[model samples]
Target: MTLAKGCTLCYQGAKMVLFVTGRCRRSCWYCPLSSERKGKDVVFANERRIEAPEEAVSLAERMSALGTGITGGEPLLCIDRVNEYSKALKDHFGKEHHIHLYTAQAPTKPELEQLAGLVDEIRLHPPRECWDHITDTDYIASAKNAKEMGFDIGIEVPALPGLELLIPALPYLDFLNINELEWGETNAGEMRERGHELADGVHNAVSGARDWADELLNHGKVHWCASSFKDSVQLRERLKRIAENTARPFDEVTDDGTIVYGVLDLHPGTRDAVVARCRTFLTEDEFSDCGDRVETAWWLLEEYRDRIPGKKSVVERYPDGGMVVEVTPL
Candidate 1:
């Protein structure tokens, strides 16, 4: 089956996740947003929080994004921000830079009109309750109207038991994405109370999620996104893209997409001596004196472990100074 334009970019690790805001009006039982963003008002381009559209543009450029997927608690809730960032990305990246947006709310004609040229695709989320009676809701009109205005329209929802109920609404959509439902920090208690469990111990996917939507796999427009694929493949590919664009000369980009480098935690008296020693043995590009610590290639530190007079270790972390993944003491 052909993937939607946005999904195609995402599968290639060429799509940036532009999180506009975390404020939403509805509380769906399966909402997997993390506690840090579930109800908070914040914006993030990938993992970096930002205060301006320019920041999002910069982040997108770093990873050479071919497209962007604007998402949030409900992006429509902050229409102004959505429009601003979408315009900024398109403006900087050119008209060919595709953009797709996800909104739980059924946008009115005015809202759809506002997003006309800025967004190329719209994925509607009609809430599970409205799936069986989608024709009776505003989503049908929204999808039809969006299509008329040049937007590729589709419906995306977490895989749930009543998925078949959405069959009647498929004709109004360009595609239907069935995302593997998974547990989240904010929804774990609720999921447990509802008797939901992980499909396996290693993945966050809900049990029976794929089986619920298995019958629709043969449909040409149906795309199934497994939770494990999102957690591993998607995330790893995205990280690899970022690491390719941002890794330092001394950093070793690992197969898993994390960068590994040597670090020397400087002591008050040994800071200068350590910096001086690093300069003598390492070229200017090979070592960096980052205030309280000195950084170099992990192999260099491993060879000169006895020569440096400070706490030494090798760290593997996400690119662009993201979260630390591992630290091995030397």
Candidate 2:
């Protein structure tokens, strides 16, 4: 299934997003990713790991993705991999497969020149959180340089209430994609201490950021995105889309760190073996017609909880003789 164009990122299932490496220059307290990037080898996608270009293309093919986005601890931090990923995708998927990037780095002319042929767009993120650290000119210069360097230039940042003092400093930017700040694995306590509380039914994300984005949209000073809200909404309305888009079935991951889908399958005379030993769940509730395929009925198996194979392996029928069902929804 092709990703819908409404999504500014991953609109077309482009797993082209490469978390080149997890090493950032700054550490914002509200950072959702936490310290996971510091010298870590996690090329984190949206609840996914992108290891190699081949695997990426495989996943994309499964999802029927049309493009790719590369971001990270700062894509420029690992320029070689950035070059590698960009070149590989453009080469593999062709140039029409939109490739975009996000970076906090201020690349020089030579660096931007190097990336010009490789990247179609560059989203500069000179964060507003650490005003004491990075400079205003640097953000503008980076945005200006990126535009000059043949990249679709824009700025991306969290829409913090404190940013009112900082937005005008970045007029050179073509677009400012301000995301709603949400608490995640990266900065739970920091956000709590800052008095960023949940907006009622909302989970980890605070309401202040919503007010922040609405104010920006009202003023029309910049093009901002409350992406977290959109993403949260997508989890439900887009379920059929998710099921249809999935190359291989995967569960969703909620903000509370819960895996929404859990399935397990066992082989052969588990009908006899599992049923005989099965204590708690009734046989009829567990399986209406148990075959090689695992139906929702089979997921009700309360017996042999420790012995059930993962769903993936059972679907693929790996040599290990047990199915493996992973519980992660993106």
Candidate 3:
């Protein structure tokens, strides 16, 4: 399948996201980090806060990840931490497990050399001011250094007006990724200050952001990632991959990668009786005890809802992590 250049693993739902640290050197006005993570020096594996490297590896295993993408406020700032985690992942998953990192800093030769040993790809995000004349910035030297070191070097930047100037650096890069500029809870005020408004009916993306991608298509190795694709495709595919591995037998995996099941809330007084009656109706493999409630196939609960004693509802949750998406009463 033809995937976006330099984003093949992400497109295939085989890349685990490793958020190393949220500390960065530069403050970009359009940064979309959530308030909890924006300036905090926290680490996360997907949405789960992590305190140890083993947790990251366990998450990758949960989703059967073929590779990892390390990102942060600036990964190079915690070079030792990056090296430690990258090596830990490589050691656990083997050298064939591809690892890529995103950084805003223009790293030095020695820094690049150390990173190159653990990473398969390096995507640099130069500051927005340098987008108008990228070749003149210090990024050019860093890109060249990374390329000479045999890393798959690329540039990734939000698609904004005047980004076409980056075409000059293409000869030195293996690819260029243009991400549709987005609005978020943390950046909404700043985005509006920059004269950006949300597109009609769209939730978090700026208007006219896509047009910038269109303007850069004629340049070779340019990949424009639409905001819709990230929500509707990349995320859903990753959820499906995780669901296939983690979903309980009683849960149904929906086409959109949400887990659908029935939950019967149990009170302390009736818990044992209700569970015993439920067991008689459902096969052992078709139901599971979930501490606060019992989960079973939605249809089965729907058919037997009136007979059961406790409040009954069908629940839908994101497959990768158990975040509720929807709940419906019988």
Best by lDDT: 1
Tens-digit lDDT track of model 3 for 209-316: 988777678666888887887888888888888899999887899988889999899898888889899888788998988778998999999999888988889999
What residue runs in model 1 are displaced by over 4 Å at the alpha carbon? none
lDDT of each structure?
0.92, 0.56, 0.86
lDDT of 1 at 264: 91
State, as a TM-score between 0 and 1, how close model 3 is to the true structure. Answer: 0.96
lDDT of 2 at 50: 65
| Least well predicted 10-residue stretch by lDDT in candidate 3 | 1-10
The TM-score-based order of candidates, best leading, equals 1, 3, 2
Worst 10 residues of 1 by lDDT: 268-277
Q: How does model 3 fare in lDDT?
A: 0.86
Q: What residue pairs clash in candidate 1, if any at all?
A: none
Q: Give me the candidate number with maximum TM-score.
A: 1
lDDT of 2 at 163: 59
Candidate 2: TM-score? 0.69
